[model samples]
Target: MDLGIAGKRAVVIGGSQALGLAVCERLAQEGVNLVVFARDAARLEEARAHIRRIREVRVDVVAGDITSEADVDRLAQVTSETGGAQILVLNTPRPPSPMRDFLDETDNERWRQAYENQLHGALLVLRKVTPLLIGPGWGRVVAITSASIKQPMPRHAVSTIFRAGVQAALKHLSMELAAHGVTVNSVAPATVITPTFRPPFHNVEERVRAVPLKRGGRPEELSALVAFLASDLAGFITGENIQLDGGQTRALY
Candidate 1:
């Protein structure tokens, strides 16, 4: 099961801990050099050390918030200095709150922040970094978005709205980048247990109660899917939102 991406450079946003770190470890296992980005410098260092322990691949850490344009610019500059990256994992942090109903979202500022942080900020990174991939005529853009894009959760309004927009943007980018041999796709996971898995609406047991499997997905399980999508093996796949939910989402598409 050689992914055929060994030694290739990848830039993973929010790669400090939890699912991001899991993705990094999987990529490192595949021998991919990494540029892991997050706001926490200390956690980034810890992730670097942990990944190095997994494999001897080059692991560079960049501390920055994706919501900040200046930080994203700095990330691109640093990545370019390291010979640029062929794979870009756009994994930003979730919206501030656990979950909120659309009608209850009275504060207009929350909507603005969600747009900036979840949707626009991701595009900022893509705008700055996708060019690096274009030059090589080979690229992978796998965004770790939520399953709400397909099956919207009851109380999750902010994340669903912005992430669905992000999905649409990626689909558009897929067609635009097809000629360049670059694929743009997203992984939508529902109830994946990570450090920040707490949703105010439901606890772990209650969250997976409706799922046919009666269990939440594991981080490594989601990470494996990400690693595959980021490899040459998934070269033909693009403009798709593949869900990693354990029969939780009923929608066929």
Candidate 2:
């Protein structure tokens, strides 16, 4: 099916590897022009090359952390280069430390940094890039979050808390932007075999014990949903926390 997004420009944050890279590749496959954002110059280039090989789409690389105001500001301008971006995929590959117990979270600075790295950072990008979409009256914002946003993970204190905050913001943004033809939503993905989850999933036996599917969710699985969400097919869906868990979560709502 044609997603009705051919030639549209998109910016995928932290899109150098794992789900981010996968999303970029899917967008390219759909004939969408992409600009991958990352803090590591090398990783961004690697993603750029990989996407170029996957399809003949214009893939630009932007190097910067999402947590920085200056970086987001720069990205906003970068979007203008491709006639203003129509899609934004906010992805953070490296989540903060897993502080299971309240006592483990000893420093206030740690909390501040955690929120800044994930929540505040993405919010800045949203602020800077909204104008590009509003002017054209069409846009897609898909946040790559974790399953903890719906079902709290034992050790993920900071990520769970802030991702829920982002989900709430996306809900509000959906309502605020609905009239303008912009959609705001999130994808709370399940377990994936990647460097990002190695630490959390160190105890492999313990981790998959609850997964009814008896397997881990792949990065591509999450990216496929993201690509759909960014496309016209998902036009009616917004303000939702769509889970990509492998039946790890049992909540029906």
Candidate 3:
């Protein structure tokens, strides 16, 4: 599949590892120049080096927290220096756990922290990158959200509430950006195996029991959908939240 994004510049937040890195790898294979951002400098560098070995695309790593406005501004600046970005893949600071009841067991401060990490971080990134997308008159912004937004996970109050807020923002932004040839959409996945965070599902059998498809998802499975969404083929798709949860949401609803 020719994603039709070769030579295009992209910014992947939290791209140092896990699902973010997997998306970068898929985009890099399509010849997209990447600016990968994360707070850990060593890990970011390692990811950059590793991607370089596998693909012949330009890759740069910026060390910073997505939750920080200063860092997001830096990312926008660096990406602008390369002529602005055409694809924005947002996969930022995830919740601590997918099955913890922060609302009942934790303090207000902890709940606030989770909200800041998920909602604020995404808003900051969008604010900083909107101009880049608007400038070109064509853009693809894909937010990597969680399936919990549709089907709430057990005891994951913080994520359930905050991630839904993110989705709402994206929904409106997609409409506002539609006329400009930019599409804003979200991909919500369930139990994707990633190094940065782990879901409570211990084994395949247990995980599959909840999903009608009877299995958890892999990083590559999620990335493939992201790749499609970021391409010209997905031009007419916007303001939509597609679930890649292997029928989990369907079964529940």
Candidate 3 C-alpha error for residue 84, in Å: 1.3
RMSD over all Cα atoms, model 2: 1.6
lDDT of 1 by residue, 1-253 (tens): 9999999999999999889999999999999999999999998999999999999999999999888899999999999987899999999678867567899888899888888889989989888888889966899999999888898998789888888889888999999999999999999988889877874634877888877888889999999999999999999999988999898778978
Q: Please give, for residues 71-140, the per-residue lDDT of candidate 3 as tens digits.
A: 8899899888877789999985777553466447457776778888899999999888866888667899
Model 3: residue 50 alpha-carbon error in angstroms: 1.2
Order the numbered candidates by TM-score, best leading: 1, 2, 3
lDDT against the true structure, each candidate: 0.90, 0.82, 0.84
Provide the clash count, candidate 2. 0
By TM-score, how accurate is candidate 1? 0.97
For residues 1-253, what per-residue lDDT tens digits would candidate 2 score against the true structure?
Answer: 8888889988898889878888888899899999888999998888898899999899888898889899889988877875778898888544566555555777788789889987898788778876677856778989888888778877678777887777787788889999889998888877765555665535656676667888877777888899999998898888887888887876877
In candidate 1, residue 246 scores what lDDT? Answer: 90
Using lDDT as the yardstick, the better of models 2 and 3 is 3
Best by TM-score: 1
